[model samples]
Structures are given as C-alpha cells and as structure tokens.
Target: MKTCRFILSSGLMLFAAAGFSQSDSTGLPGDDFSLQGALALFKRSSSVEEFEKLLNTESSNVNNLDLNNDGQTDYVKVIDKFEGGVHAFILQVPVAENENQDIAVIELEKNGNESAHLQIIGDEDIYGEEVIVEPDGDDAGTAMMMPSSGARYDHGPAAWLTRANTIVVNVWTWPVVRFVYSPSYVVWVSPWHWTRRPVWWRPWRPVSWNVWRPRRAVYARHYVVVKQRRVVGARQVYRPMRSTSAIVRTRYSASVGRYRATRTSTTIQGKNGRKVKVTKTKVRRRR
Candidate 1:
C-alpha cells in the first residue's frame, strides 16, 4: 500500500508484497559493505534510523532526494550486484513495497565476478562494475568516473539503452531495475540476488513486478554532456503518453541533435470508434 500505484496506461491498480533475507553473498567484499550483508541488515531492521545507519556504513557516498515532496528523504543507495547474468539492485527501506520494487534477483558466480557483463544494453555487453544510476535522468545516466581516462560512462541498470556513449536513452517513467553502485567505492546490495525463487514473506498474496518498476526517474529522457570535467548540459524531456499500453524505443542520431522515438501501441475502439493514443514520440535532444 505504500507504493504509489498509478494507472498503467489506463485503470488504476494496487498491489503489495514482502520478503526478507538473513543470508549473505560470498565472493563480494565479504564484509558488511557487501550486498548480502546489507540485505540481511535491512530485512531485520526494527526502525528506519537503524536501516539508514547500515546504509551509511556500506556506501561510499549517498544521494539524497525528496521523491514525493514530503521533505523527508526516502531513498538511500548502495553497491551493485550481479547474479546469474542479471544485476540485482537493493535500495534501502526494506518493506513489502521496496521488496517487490525489485524486478530481478541475481545469483552471482564465484570466479566470474570481475569479468561478468551484468547486462547487454543496446546490445553492448557492459561489465557490472561500470554501470551508473542517474536518479534525475538528466541525460547523464548514472556513471562511474574512470581516473585513467577522465571520462564517465553510462552504467545505470536500465532497459533498452545503447552501449556506453552511443546516446543514453531511457523510458523516463517506465521502471527498470537498478542498483545504486560505484566501481571504486564500497556498495550495499540485496540478498534477493541469491535466491532463484521468489521470496514469500509477504502477509498477503504476491502480484507481478511488471508493474516491473524502474528504480530511478523513468518518465523522461535525458542527454547529459560533461566537458572539461564539468557538466555542460543535462536535459530531461517527457515521453509521449497514450491511453493504451505502448512501448517506446528510441535511437539518437548524434549528427542531427534529435531523438526519434518509435512508439507502438494498441488502441481500443470506444463507442464512437475513437481510438486514442500517441501515434508518434518526438523530443528534441537538448544541447
């Protein structure tokens, strides 16, 4: 009930879920900072204060934002985890809503940790340690700064995006699972990665994760530009909305300074035979 359930294209739906973990993942730092340990602590935390204390200890840095405008910070970030070829991201606030907010549970292999490309976005296999989660979708996908090259790479756990530097694309409001991670810094993750089956600690029946939420702001588009160690531009534009379910896939032609979104949807005929939906998605890539 804590999740803000909005109408998915149409019709408002409500769902709740819960689960917990007392186990830890090996092969990571094997310390409290590891994803598994953080999950263990979040599951058993008796109070919000205690959960945040655990988060502060495990993360190298934290990004604070008032997601609902309540003026109280709702999110605390952690490290990234890879399980069975998918990245399992854990955010603080261990509850039924946050538990189900997770889209995938990853299981990691012992020796393959370093070489694992957690996912192939836009068909490019990106290593797990290099991804970033930009909460604001400000064109700058969450990135890790490589000291050797002085360049940042787009690494957030998003769906349907091109490889690093091709032109970062996200569905703005559509949810894609992501872990708050930094390559050079310590991170906390979820033990959900260890389980192959869905955990049933919820007091009620579980529902689908598709109602699969994206961890960061998934409703807009951003193209971030950083030049000379400074962010020159970061822009977020809303995606085209429709009355029916649709999927928008976008490709950027860097030479043209524009983003073209090809949206596909099915329209239901009303009594008047009116089918309502956005036939096209057009957003100018801000410079």
Candidate 2:
C-alpha cells in the first residue's frame, strides 16, 4: 500500500510539472512582437525618425508582425507628441486604406535636469492587456526607504512592500532619453505614410513562433514588466489617438480569451507543511 501511494503521488507531481513547462513555453500570436526589443532599440536611437527606420529593418528582429495579413512584415512608424515636458512616441502601422493601428507607445517624462522616467506600453488589443515594460534596477534600494510622510517601519520587508507599490524608473542617464530631454532636441515624427516608406526599409517574412520565442531572451534580461504607469500625463495625451488593427485585435482577443477560461484550482502542500490552494491556467486552442 505504501509503495502504491508513493508511485501515485510521484506520477501526479510529474504530470503537474509537465503542464507547467508546456504553459510557460506556449507562444501566442501576440508573442511575435517584443516590447523589450522596442525599448532597447529606442535607447539606441538618437531620434524617433531613426527609431522608425530601425524598427522596419529586417535584421532588427524587434518587429515580426504581419498585422495586415499581407504576407510581409508591417512597417512601423514613430510619432512623437510633447506636452508639459513629457515626450510620448507613438508606434503605429497602417493596416488599411484609412485605418492605422497603434502597436505601442514610449512615454518619457523629465522631472528635473538629471531625473526622468520612461515606460513602453503595448496595446491591449495586441498584447491582451495593458502590458507596460520599464527599466527596473533601483527598486531594491528605493523600496527600503520610508514614505514621504517619514513614518517609521518595524519590519524591513513591509517597508519594502510599501514603497514598492509605486515605482518610478529613472532613465535620465540613458543616452537617448537624455538627448530627448535636452534643450536642443526637436520632436521626431516619421515622414512616411501609407504611400511613402523609407527607401532602405525592406519587409521580410516573419519567423515561426518556435523560432521567435527564444529570441526574447536577449532583451528580457535588461527590462522588467511593471504594473504601474510612471508617465501618466504623457499617456493620457495619447488616449484620443490610441488605435489597434481590427484584424489582429480580433484574433488576439479570441486566442487569449479561450486561454483565460481554462483555469482550474487544486490544493498542494507547501514547504511549510501546510496545504495551499493554487490555480493553474492552461491554454486551449482549436486545431
């Protein structure tokens, strides 16, 4: 009886591990474009015009989306909007004769001469949520500090958790971010429309999900996804102009919606020798 029980428990553990591995690796249509890659490219660009050119280049590998279903990668354009020291660069692509879909937006705000915040937000229609990626590294120190009220904390992790609720990544030291905040800097907007694209730009066939999934590791190391928006004012200015491709939007929503519905819960023993209820979410797709 003891041997049989051990075998049953081991098999169940193996089954759960396999499920987790598959869920972690499974790629969705939205996974083709990497926001981390976009943020990294933006850091390297001197201006938004140069950024747009780099985004469309086949070798860049940042953009692998065919939103228009035209059998070629779509050309992404950059439009910079400035208001009250905030610079919001909108990344968009034309999918139809009159419709232009927004892929993402890079928002930057300069608080002082040497302090600034930056964040890149992926469109919900494309990413299935308001996916925001920002540069994070100083949070460990920032979280240890007290609140603006100068309150006292008895616990260290509690203090860390309190200040961590609101994280503002300062990217002023970043070369391109500093350039944008400089007095000599001018707003950059792509000259290319549906009729005009960069002469050097050549769209290529997008790679398979299996090939593209591993490429994210390059940019994933440098950035982190945060729940809060640091540049709210700049993002607010873009509210009226935000748009998404209907074709891609519908497909992404359907694929993501199905996955969200397949959640199940089970009780498992924790390291503390206590039972904890955990929910497992699995994706279901039609063959």
Candidate 3:
C-alpha cells in the first residue's frame, strides 16, 4: 500500500500568511532569492543539468541572488543527494573561494512506483525561517475565502486547522521528478563553479527590492507555505548536509535590523487566545 504522510513539529503555530505581501513587508535579504521562482523553473526543466543552466541563465530572470554582495548575480549550482526513496536537490551558490551557501533544497520522496511528494524549503539563514512551499492541490481552491491585498486567499479546509494543513501533491506527475526516481537515474552534481562557468551564462547586477518583489509575486502565487515536513525521510538525509553561509547570515542580519527599525506594529496572542494587534509606541526613557 502506498501511503503519504506529513509529520508536524510542535511549536508556536502561525497561520499561513499570503506570500510576501504583508503591509509591514520591508523586504529581507531572502527576498532576492525566490523559492517559488525556483520551483516554477524546476517544473519546466527536463533534467537536473538543464535546471542548473536555467537557474544561472541571464535571461531566465528566475535567479536574482547575490549572496556575496558582489556586483554580479551568483551562479546557482544543483547537487542531488538521495537515500532509498528520498531525494534532496540542494541549490547552492559559490560565495567565496572555499565557501558555498545553500539557498534552498528541493525534497522528494517516492511512496510507490507512481507516487511521490515534493517540497522546497528555503534555508533559515537566508529566509529568516523554515519556509516550505509546495504545489497547490485542486482542493486548495475550496479553502475558506479571505480578503488579502485586494485578492481572495484560501486557507485549505481541514477538520482542525493547525499551523499548516496537509495536502496531497503527487509530484510523480512532474517529468523531472519521475526521472529522478527511475532506476537508471544518475545523481547530478554541477561541475560549473565560480571561475568555471558556461559561456552562455552572464551574471547581472542585483535589482532593488522594490523592483524584484513584483517579479517574485508572479511565481509566489503558484505555491503555498506548508509548515509540516511531509517528506520525513528526505528531511533526515538533508539535516546532516544542510549548511548556512556566514556571509549570507551577516547580510541577512543587517537587512533584518533595517526592517525592524521601520516596523509599525506586531501581532501577539491575547489572554483570551485571540490574536491582538499591538501598535508601536515610542516610550521616552527616564533620564
């Protein structure tokens, strides 16, 4: 019997917010790299090698990450790691001579010959949290209607809504995903590095947050944030190899600091268990 399950972790549960469209969104370093965009590109790619080229292609417009703060956009390399039925495609960038930063991971777990589940997780150091995005199921359309930024948003229907509701996304239907699960599949590790890259590739300067946000939204609308780790096997295999770049972390911290300085309000849980919106107030400190 083929079975798919998502194991939820215990913590402070947060309702799924519309993708990066909050009023208080001042943007972070993570904004430059879009997991939604990556997933969209991945779907179009036929193989891992082609996916790597698409990621670094100048005209693709899917990648805008400049993790090293260099004048040019970073070349994203793909590395596939697999164990049993789980495969983790680590999307990484060479930030320094001897250092590489993992931007996000495309995780897939095969439940049967024709059944698989997939999700992409953004690295916390870059994204400020464990952001998981997967394809929107047909039933996702039936989620409760709520107004968000002038558009209707749906929080999928479940008996009990928690931080993230489970949905079945059979990635086996995706060509590249199914190819990776085949017996003849070979693990793909990108050969192109900082000094050695494809002649067709040309890096461009990173754009301002304001300009990139809209481009990102185009891809973001196709995905949904799910907090639960459905592919447990893939998660376990990736944890040991998962890495964060110190350089990216430093830049992320600076971006966060700047964002906090201009933030107006924050949400907190009230005594009655409902969410309370608390406005920011400047309290003059006594001399």
Candidate 4:
C-alpha cells in the first residue's frame, strides 16, 4: 500500500510538471508568475543542475553562503545571459548541515524557448526526503496538511515548515473569489531554527463611527490692545478781585471782607462729541 501511494504521488508530480512545461511554452509573457508554476518546477528538479538546465538556457557562476549560519552552505542565484533578457537560475544543496559531504545541484534556465532542461550533478542521496504538499481536500481552494498545524487564515492554499520536531503551519484563503493574488510572506528565525509564516487574514468591514468621531471641541482665549488719547477740559481764565481799604490813623488798613468774587466754568467734549461739565469751586488770594 505504501509503495503504491509513493508511485501515485510520483506520477502526479510528473503530470503537473509536464503541464507547467506546456504552459511556459504557450502562456502570455509579463503575466504574474503562479504558485502552481513554482510548485511544478520545484517538484520536477530536485538538484541545482536539473533545475538550471530545465528552467534556464544559460549558466553562470553563483556564490554560496550559509545565510542561516547552519554550517552547511546553501545558495541560489540567477544570471541573465542577454543584457536584459531571460534569466538562468542555479541552486546548490547539501545532504546535511553538519557533514562535509555535498549533495545535489540543479540548474534552471529561461529563454524565449518554452521547453526547459533539467540536469543533475554529482551523486544524489536517493534516500533523501522531499516535502510533499497538495490540496487539503476536494474543496477547490482549500489546503490541508497530512500532519495538521493549528494556525489557519481565511484565504489560503496553506504552507508548512517542519524542523526540529515541530511543524509550523500557515493557511490563507483568498478574499476575492475569481482573481489570483500574491500571498504575503513572513519569516521567523531562532538560533538553530528558522521558518516562514503566511500573512494574517481578516474580512473587510466598514470603519466604525466611534473610532473616527471628532474629539471634544477646544476653546482658546485671545486679547487685542487698542490705543486712543482722551482730551480733558479747555484752558480757564481767572479775574483779579479788588479789596477796600478801611479808615484808620497813620497807615490805612485793608478790609478783607469787602472783596467781590468772580466764577468761571468750562465744558469738555469727548471723541463722540458728548459734552462734559466742569466747575470752579473756590478762589484764593496771594499776599
């Protein structure tokens, strides 16, 4: 039963690859690359040589580095033969991280031609395991895992990462029913561990009025300064009073009670032509 399942899986992979090859030959250029194409190519070519020759038309040197510091070097690069034309990709893979041994290298090339080549270089580990992914169920867009993971998103064809005895899973569903879109990529890394998670999905909802309500009205105080000169009363004129002398011996004495008083009053006007009254109360004599 296990052998039959393996053979069935292998046959399905080959069929998918052949379908992609045909599509590449005939599909319109400058269109968004599909996940289906990536999966098909990923399945058909397991080594760098096979990937490059199968998907690309030319080859160039690619530098290798351990981006994750996993001790084993893993690298993938693409070179464009024409100044601005199709690109050829190459990738190198090692059997294991700790071992000094080398594993498979594959090459993929893209030219105007539709047919791709797949070539294998060096000895391959036949026992090496490959990750298998497929639709979760008979549902048109649903994706499921053979070993289930807890996380799920609304729009999906799900993805999973298995490492260090733990499987991290991410499932997403498309919001639009008819159109195909790109999936968001997320990465998580730890010492000795690394994985990717798909973007979180949420339904579109109308914005809440409470969230955008205007804040309480604020009032600020301001003052203005005005300059104006005020005019008082006009100048007043004073008249002198005469005193009567009293009859006596030798030097005549002046009688203080015999004097007559004269009074003066003035009127003042404001800027608006309003009249204001002014009174002179008393008179004084200087000796």
Best by TM-score: 2
Clash count (model 1, backbone only): 24
Q: Which of the predicted structures, 2 or 4, would earn the higher lDDT when compared with the native?
A: 2
Give the Å shift of residue 282 in candidate 1: 1.5
Candidate 1 vs candidate 2: the lDDT winner is 2
Q: What lDDT does the true structure give each of the candidates?
A: 0.25, 0.71, 0.70, 0.24
* Candidate 1 residue lDDT tens string, 1-287: 33434444223222222121111111111111223233333333443235445544313112222222233433333324443333333342222232321111222111112211211111001111111222123433332222235533343334323333333323222212222222432334434321221233211121122221221113223323222211111101001110110110111122112221222345666668887753333321111
- Could you tell me the TM-score of candidate 4? 0.16
**TM-score list, all predictions:** 0.23, 0.73, 0.71, 0.16
The weakest ten consecutive residues by lDDT in model 4 span: 230-239
Provide backbone clash counts, one per model: 24, 0, 0, 32
Q: What TM-score does candidate 2 get on C-alpha atoms? A: 0.73
lDDT of 4 by residue, 1-287 (tens): 99999999999999997665443321111011111222234344433334333332211111122323344323322221111221222122222343222222222221112222122221112111111122222332332332235543222344332233332222123221111111231111111111211222111222222221111000001111111100011001000111111111111111111121223468999568999776442442110
Error of 1 at 193 (Å): 18
For residues 1-287, write the lDDT of model 2, one tens digit per residue: 99999999999999997665456542444576788888878877776667778788777778888887778888888888888888889998888767788888998886554566678988766665567887655431122322344544334222332354454545555677767777888888788778877778878988766566567557787677866786779867788878766666665676656555676789999988999998665643211
What is the lDDT, from 0 to 100, of the residue 160 in candidate 4?
A: 31
- What is the clash count of model 2? 0
